[model samples]
Target: MKQFRLHKVASVCLIAAMALIGCSSQGGEKAAPGTQPGASEGSGQQVTLSMHSWRVEDTEGYKAIIQAFEAENPNIKIDFKPFKATEYNTILNTALQSDSGPDILQLRPYAPGISLAEAGYLEPLDNIAGISAFPKDVLAAATGKDGKVYGVPLSLNSTQFFYNKKIFEQNGLKEPKSWDELIATAKTLKEKGIVPISFGAKEGWLLSLSHGVIAPASYSGSGYIDKLLKGESNLQSPEFLQSISRMQELIPYFPENYVGLELNDMRTLFATEKAAMFINGSFELEGLKKLNPDLQLDFFPMPTNDQKAVITTWVDGSYAVNAKSKHKPEALKFMEFMATKKFGELFANQFKRISAVPGVSTDDPLVNKMAELSQSSSTPYLMVVHFAEGKPTTKQALENALQGMYLGKLTPEQVAEEIQKSAATWFPPFKK
Candidate 1:
């Protein structure tokens, strides 16, 4: 039984005060060359450390962090590179296997962390400084089955149905509180010639958002995933099947070529007010803000058939050190810098990420409201947290199968059976 505790954010004034106070041991001191071995010293024999991440929006945020870090240690240079979200894993996998990976790697803790750590490509960070600042459940996500910490969590993410508040108000549309109401609202919106939802299904990975947003309300308190893993239940259960049907019902409200649209396209549709609603994780709020600061946005949990709305959240975005990096010392120094509370503040305030570090708060009003919703009723994203180990995991299979459903090539029952079939290969005796 993993506890889900939503740590409250500290005041912005307090965070700013702390940043000015320079509490971390690094403080504001520029050391001489070789003063701290791997750290940058004033003598300026620069140590360039490369980092790889999937967040393009984080470029400026990280640059600010790097600037602060370099202020104290003038001899180190950080080379940060961001890859496309869809192509990141493939490129990272190749780089790691060839011993040509970045010094610092940003990754998702579940499947990717597990695979890289198992292959000895990620360095365990059990001794990382300031690690105790993170909540136990948050830290646990980045720890492997072998009890070694391979990554430090950067954010705890929550996904909800983000709707254009102004659109809803202008159209006389009330936020739906039940699955049936949701469909009715969509129908009404479609009647008025507006896209009801702006979900992008073309990016294979984005398909999971279709169901992930619905998983919490459908299965959270039931210990459903645990039963499936222990072989006491399966995806074919009536309850699970019905959940798939709930997602399929949204197809008619989407764009005709919804399967051809990528996530960016969906964001454009919503931010441009072409779509009334879209399901997205909190990470997108910052980007959305930049896209249209005047865009009035609000969110509600994906309404369930049973009418118990629960926010689906996951511990997402972690930083891992490459096991074979020649600049381990420099990389470790940067990791220590990230562990600081000030870095957490910067992450929350500047990058618009829900910081994993304690006592950090965002100034964004919408983010704070979403955080409150998360605290009120939330559950971890199921497949990301509970899938049995194997290729084509339940997460992967669900994504693929849902894409079929979006294309009208698969029924809800077929989707359920497909998931069971995929899980059966990894967990024996899976129900048919």
Candidate 2:
């Protein structure tokens, strides 16, 4: 009788459990087609994705952007992690190689991004609905050699001269219209006990950035770049040598002991009003503003002998999905949102950068001026945009040679020769 009673109790419990499961099935929402087995869009199950970037300074900006994304996707959350810029590549590569990277990551533009895709670390974004909105040139930065788009272009960066408006006004200076005028302005600033340019050579990459700002106008912009790409010209060409010489000429006006200084030191000099001008990329605007909110800043492209200025512009970076991510659908949804105009506007307004997405405009007058300048006259940032492929890339060669030149270990001619030799070793057109 006791055994019979125990079996009756067991049967009643089983019936209760089945009734509860039936209630859940009848009342709960069904999973969306093609979704994961237990989780679906608006199914009340939340997912968190990890994202990594090198823009540590933009932490707050990204937080606000993520907040907006999360609001639209209540079931999804993003955790953004940014590492120091100098250390990011190594860290990201290590994580990716081990298949332990974040679900999404910020990619370096052009060859660097392509390499990640080629290594099978990145997912191809060809089928993403929003990728079609970007221009081909913009898309090229994140495209692999196999013709797959691996990321969404984030911003178009322009390298130029950023000047303190108050300093220029106090020094009785007008914007220079030619190379000679720029030299004269620097001389006047130096005479007034002001550092004419807040520049440094400690970091090799900045040398390339400075070159992008100063060289394009000297080489006649895209025309010269095309010649170099086709094997019609080399880095040792007179125009290219002239560009190298221009960098040498600016050394006298640089901050004292500039060779020992890094990017932050250079920025401090300018932001504190200890220096009159700085040659840097448009991306520095937000950081400079954050350093000194009262700073009065403006920018101008470096001018050529012919008095025409061409902005050196390139796609700065992109956001890519990791191929090893377990949450590909959710990560892809975030990527699709990033490619939208809404995200573009949010990015531009928050970061004060020129959005790669078309039709996204900024209210900041200075940023607007940059956008206008880009549209009117621009050239690809030569080394990074075109010659950044192969072992010991031309970009790397130029950066190293430029650093040597700054330290008086190499002359402009020698720097040019070294770069030419490096490019010839791997660049197909140069080999021909």
Candidate 3:
């Protein structure tokens, strides 16, 4: 029942924002990093920079975030084009090929940078900010095979188990420290007329978020997805099947009608006190808090079998420079601001995620707990969140496979086999 939550987990979009004054500032656009702004040195004429995104609810928070940057530097204007994930991707894939489109938008690291870089459509950004201190995985996600960086990560996070504090204490149970303990505790709660785990199985990302997403890390035996992506290993193998089998063992522990539950169901089960535990990302803290601010919370990194603890992580976040925008310089300056602690403090406090910048803190005790759990990993392994739906051809097939697995229609071996088949045809080309 510990499944992924979408309202809490962010998907890829083409995210971009301009650092202009409150809709009035003007200046030459900022550059991404490795390349100069692809415009005349200084053009002040109506540079209405637009960026597309699938994050609608988060826009207000992000707007507040960008406003702080805008207050500090009032030169470039930003127009946010917001849409749901599905619509945004559909429009974006089409827009990237058209003349009229956003300067930046949200995208998964491998898909956006790698594919676009291969197409020779993305502008390199290594020269401008010189983000030398940036974490290697963050830098790696942005860089194409040619070693050109196309974007920067705005936040760093790892998916973990988020469970009810009251439930554990009431059941005379401690938060589980091992897979066996988890099963024992969940059984105790379920027998008491309380579901032990809550999750949104209806969403494909949730399945991927909780289980399918970590195939590369588990299969490679390297214990990290970022490492596998760096030519460290192959994905279509039995080691990955081992991880999928582990998840399958827990299906009996999920709600009896688990397949009937949709994307928000499991989260709702926990939020309403019907379930004792849930597994999701730190981003869910905001919504979970809004429902019950006193919701006592704690997190444990996803379990491991003989291997070290691993967390499925998304190494990329929304925000990219347009390859054709006139206000590139101004946009990048704002991005620099985003890369600062001030920006992290302003935006990351509520989502409960750890900031990528050097310094930022939250008074919330739970966020600190998740951060503490992640300290064991070298750099957060971004590979656990291997994006299967890299393009239109693969997205639907992967989604169907996820749905089939949830319904018991597909066994772990079958799930692994189907995904393995897609991996050959679906792995998009690296950037040019």
Top of the candidates by TM-score? 2
Scored by CA lDDT, what does every candidate get? 0.74, 0.81, 0.57
- Ranked by TM-score from best down, the candidates are 2, 1, 3
Give candidate 1's whole-model lDDT.
0.74
**Each prediction's TM-score versus the true structure:** 0.88, 0.90, 0.78
Per-residue CA lDDT of model 2 for 1-432, tens digit only, reads: 000011122222212212110111112333222253443466677889999999998899999999999998988899999998889999999999888999999999877776776676877777777788776667777765445678898998889999999999998998998899999999999999999999999998899999988997787667777676568898899999999999999999999899989999999999999999998999999999999999999988878756788888878779998876877778878888898989989999899999887788888988888888787777778777766765777898998999899888999999999988988887766888
Runs off by more than 4 Å, candidate 1: 1-44, 220-222, 428-432
Q: Tell me the deviation in Å of residue 157 in model 3.
A: 1.7
Q: Between 1 and 2, whose TM-score is larger?
A: 2
Query: How far off is residue 259 in model 2, in Å?
Result: 0.5
**In model 3, which runs have C-alpha deviations exceeding 4 angstroms?**
1-48, 212-239, 378-399, 424-432
Per-residue lDDT of 205 in model 2? 89
Model 1 earns a TM-score of: 0.88
User: How high a TM-score does candidate 2 get?
Assistant: 0.90
Give per-residue lDDT, candidate 3, residue 117. Answer: 49
